[model samples]
Target: MLLLGMAWTLPNTLLGLLLGVAGLARGARTRWQPGELALVFHRYPWGPGGAMTLGNVILNTGASLEVPCRTYACRAGLGTEPPVLLADHEYAHVLQYLVLGPLFLPLYLLCGGIGVRNRFERAADRYAATGRGWWPWPAPRLP
Candidate 1:
């Protein structure tokens, strides 16, 4: 299943590798995050100083995942905002990428690109908080 997912998201993963290579040229370092099954590049000197997930690759603006995950609490507008682990949030995205394959990017943009209004992001946060319900599309209930 892992190999299948890697193949399914190969295109996006390739794009991610290109970006990672560029980051490496500028002093960024990388590590394989086994838990997430993703390659993470940190200390990347670009972007808005956060993390961005591209398929199985995760790019971080800080030295470690915790650095960016702890930057701000992941609040789902539930009155009380609790800290959401960025790693788990990003792993949710990887799961999304696996399920959606190449369609994830286009569909993500169609939803709202990025922000509180994006259902994808919300679902990811929910997954990070509760460890389930990552599927954004409605699933038929099993009888």
Candidate 2:
């Protein structure tokens, strides 16, 4: 029984680690320079129940702007916030690259990851303008 459990658990653990590393690598490949912007990480313990109960905030800041946002998943706990191994800016840009299109590439390359993140941050604002919240987790506080 122990051997069987280990066999199953080992592979899963390795796979998760690999995915985490891949995510980080993608972030590093698109990091921004200092003074250009900032990335903030926030961990929320009071998340929903089930597969996505944790939350994280990504903040980007430059000379005249600041963007703050959150993303969450339940099953992963607080650790799911951009994976601690990855820089918040890098992680945010990776997400932008994934969600946005190649239009973000020039920003990512020229202004660095911070620019890509800013574009996505603006996108999120536009999304919010539709009056629909994009967060997937349950409401943090119930009425």
The TM-score values for the models, in the order shown, are 0.89, 0.21
Model 2 C-alpha lDDT per residue in residues 38-93, reported as the tens digit of each score: 22222212223111100111222222123333332212243233312123323333
User: How many Å off is the CA of 89 in candidate 1?
Assistant: 0.6
After superposing all C-alphas onto the true structure, candidate 2 shows an RMSD in angstroms of 17.1
Clash counts per candidate, in order, are: 0, 7
- Poorly placed runs, candidate 1 (over 4 Å): 67-78
Error of 1 at 23 (Å): 0.6
User: Tens digits of per-residue lDDT for model 1 on 92-129?
Assistant: 88899988889999999999887767878878877877
